[model samples]
Target: MNSISYFLQPDSILFNSQDIDFKMPFGATACGEEITFNILTEVSINCLDVRLILKNGKESEFKLYKKKEKKIRDRDYIVWSLHFKTPSLPKTLFYHFKFLIGNSNSIFYYGNNSLGLGGVGSIYENHPIDYQITLFYKNNPSPKWFKESIAYQIFPDRFCNANRDGKLNATKENSFIYGRWNDKPMYIKNSKGEIVRWDFFGGNLKGITQNIGYLKDLNVGTLYLNPIFEATSNHRYDTTNYHNIDPILGTLKDFKEMVRECKQRGICTILDGVFNHTGKDSIYFKDASRSTKSPFYSWYRFKEYPYDYDSWWGIKDLPCVNELEPSFFKYIVEGENSVVNHWMKTGIKGWRLDVADELPSFFIENFRYKCKKIDSDAIIIGEVWEDASNKISYGQRREYFNGKQLDSVMNYPLRTYLLNFYNGSIDSETLLKYMNSLRENYPAENYFSNYNLLSSHDVKRIKTSVKDIVKCFNIDTQLQGAAVTRVLKSLSLIQFTLPGVPVIYYGDEVGLEGGKDPDNRRTYPWGSEDSNLLKWYQKITSLRYNSKILKKGEVKFFSPHPDVFGYIRYLPNTNDFIGVISNRSPYKSKFFKLNLKELVGQFSNNITTDIYLWNESLIVPIDSSTDFPIKIPPLKTLLFSSKSV
Candidate 1:
């Protein structure tokens, strides 16, 4: 917006990075890789010179040569092009194109789209926006085990309790246990909105051990368990001690048994590592609380002898730790007996870091180096809610995906945009551009291993967020509400099929619904789960489990209508593929004729496939040449596979 239309026409110059013809090697690329940029100007513009402005450590400009003149839509246009290689150092490249147009000598700029979704961009006479190209290390590839796995996140205090006698394990002092297994979670807050006594639902490691078969049957290959260490809070994010499993959950032996059971069933475990802070009541903090001569004195920053100290986000109960402190750093990643290595010895496969943005880069670099030294197959995923490629934390640009740090990030952007698309807040074209923008920014290694999920422990359940009875778009049908349940099913279907490691939150698949923190972390409704939703999850997950193309195949996204978004996952050099077309408009249902002639080739004109009818299944032979009409129901999704069958 903020457009100044004075210097000439706005759409006179055209450039879009999302298209390969305009920008080669789309999105992010490895260091020293060659990149090409192209721009088109209408013949009447009389463009004199073109320059590519780049901002890395400083601002630099490079000239763009005239490639040719071409006719498009009955108009002659000038083509300007540039070829350049990224610098040797790993950094984010921010650039924009400028033009000297007309005899007036006014300079106009071509920048990212007005919305910053970054497909085709707009022309600006002033304050042009810069596009991002991430440059990363070339040789770093994520562990194969991670890329192919479908992960499940569990909140221990609320998942299950397997004891026959039904008694809590080593109950903590200041906590209350729910009387019934299905009781809603209610925090015991005081006048200051602080939880005075944490509540427990008696879900333990033994419960998880008992449900290993259930998880295996659900096709889960990875388990991302929330904080299991000894802590004052039920969430265990504030660590009392890293060595002990929270007694309320189980003993150290109990955790080992769970890991052993998971590994035997071909499931991997990733523990939550919270190194940014520790519980104020922890042994280290307590020792430093009294007297300035404690060995842990240097571990924390104290305003006055430890009575006043720096805490995470100014929370008094959690005292922040100086992560790179000599003794603390040594304790965390220094030796074989270190906290990270100590847990790795217990047979867990990876770590999901908490508040990763706050932890310094040197700390994470060493964290990865040491853990990979122990088991190179193990992975590290960080909790970063934004685009991690150019994330700036505490005034420092983080190099998380430079092939030196994290294998993947928590992909909170996917959750936001996916929900937005389903609610009809954003059209399908915007959705396509937003997703392509991410693919263009992140390297292929991290992109495939991204921790994708629709809902997590921190937010509302997907069902509660999207489940609604609404009127249809047809003028004849818009009079009353139509009670049809399709949003959750469609959302999960899309999540499973997208490029990344899809993660299912604890009770999302079973249709558990809630809002915000304590509410979102509800106990899994054991016997009363929605059968329809549960079976839907199983079918899609099973489809993913059995298909190689769904896991590692190449992807191309398309949006034939503003309300419809689609993608194709196919193995290279073959016509074998899977296609998904989702109509997210709450009111309108569009009959879509998908165009994949170029991708599927002319020979495979008649394709044999089975299209999922959500609650039912049927065999539907489709035309790959876009002639076949695919009926897409409102607030519903359609997935048809040729080879995945």
Candidate 2:
């Protein structure tokens, strides 16, 4: 298929007419390649020459040729050709065309008809053509693994019980299992009737290693296990030892084996890096608490009594580390093959930073640099929950795109906005507000690579959010279960199709619903999966991976209304792509104009089909209006591909 396909204005069923142009990729290199743009306009009137002006400071001459038989399907376009390099340097370039009738200097403006067709044609009668072109290279792998991957987050102990041979020491206080060495520690019961159960179920690294194939079946290419470093708690966020794997999680040999196995299977491992603080029972903290003679005493800040100890947010059980101390910094980041480099050497791909906002920016920058030096592809994902660009962590501002820190941070803003919109927390106004916020704060490349999630171990599942609202407001009878399902389904469609890498948190794909923290961290309901939702999720994943535009394309938002949201994703370099239209309401929206030309390429007629659902009869063609008026169903997300409808 031709790479650059362009269309002119004032045509009904723009795609059916012979009035269009097309181009093929040419002069290719690792950095980029040029596209041979073609002209398809049919005119009896005599025309002189047609040309394209690139967004960069370069221009290409389009040569008109006789009509030929280069039809992909029922439609055929006139051919014109040109060569363009991505960019010799930095800056964005727009691709548009101009036509000279008999060399009279009267230029016909063909604006950046490169993306989609709204507001893209010439705004002025005799203006030069334009298409916004941003320069991008092909070789830079993102440093944030979590953002680019389909991560399966597991709370190690609760995932599976691998060996039935393990037993718990019932006599021990607050500990649940014995000789269960691995990620599983112990679950304890409080003296009160309340079950203070943060206990282990004997699941170990061996257990996870055994189930690598199981995760792969769910399209999980990355595994984010809760902290496995030696620590006192079952969850192990508090580190007792930074260099050694928790004895319960397995010996370093076992961990090494697991990393090897995962790498072999194309699965990346991301361990939780908890550097914000340490447990009071930690080796350094224990010695520091014991006496002043202990050399580690200087590692922590302390006063006369236990109440005077430096803690993370005043939590005495977790004492904060002194990042200002050069020795501790060396121990964690700079030691020969230390924590970060050591794990990377073991083939573990990256670190999901815990409380990154609290860690010093300088430390994170240095940490990421060291990891890159060890392996350039080693990714570092920060746990900053807000707009990372506007976020200020640790009382000082942190800049991720400055090229020294995290590859990408968790997109909390996008997650919250999606959840709130689906759950009806606020309104479309709020959704649109955050959507604009995301576009402005994140760079285009990073936006595509940002970790887009609806629910995670840290928050309630999306189903639970809507369900809880129903139960709390006593609206159970008012809104039926089917109503809630429909709403969630529509939202899921949007989440899966939108920008950024969509991630399904463990059992979320199976419709597991629970609320916040421990509740949200329930055991994966192994065999009792919700078949309908699971199938729906599979369809979503399949669609995501199938569409190049959805994976990597320029996103353009057009006329965002209170009840309807319309946007287009264009991969100007590819022949296959689509326009995504969504209606956040439960009723079919009227008087809504969805502009398709705003996409990277121009379509003479707005008729397009759903690539995945081609034979499903869901395909719809564009009307004769300049902007297509879509009769989008309530709680529906519609996708339109450029091919047959």
RMSD of each: 2.8, 11.5
Candidate 2 residues lying further than 4 Å off, grouped into runs, are: 1-148, 165-173, 176-197, 305-307, 469-479, 573-575, 587-593, 598-630, 643-645
lDDT of 1 by residue, 1-645 (tens): 356455455557778787788899877888998999888888887999999999998999999999999887787889999998899888988999888987567777888876666778788777888898888888878999889989999999989998887788878887888899888898899999988998888889999999999898779999999999999888998899888888889998999999999999999999999999999888889998986899888899999765899999999888999999999999999955899879999999889999999999899989998889889988999999998988999998888998889999999999898877866678888888888878888899999999998888898877767643233233244332232357677778888888899999988888798888899999999999988778878888898898898899878888888888988887776657777888776666788555556545432444443332332365555444444467887777887766425
Question: What digit string (tens of lDDT, one per residue) describes model 2 on residues 498-587?
Answer: 777776777787777778766676666667778887777777666665566677665655446676665666665554555666665654
Ten-residue stretch with the least lDDT total in model 1: 475-484
Model number with the top lDDT:
1
TM-score for each of the candidates: 0.94, 0.70
TM-score of model 2 vs. true structure = 0.70
Off by over 4 Å in 1: 1-11, 468-484, 598-616, 623-626
lDDT of candidates 1 onward, in order: 0.84, 0.62
Model 1 CA lDDT for position 22: 87
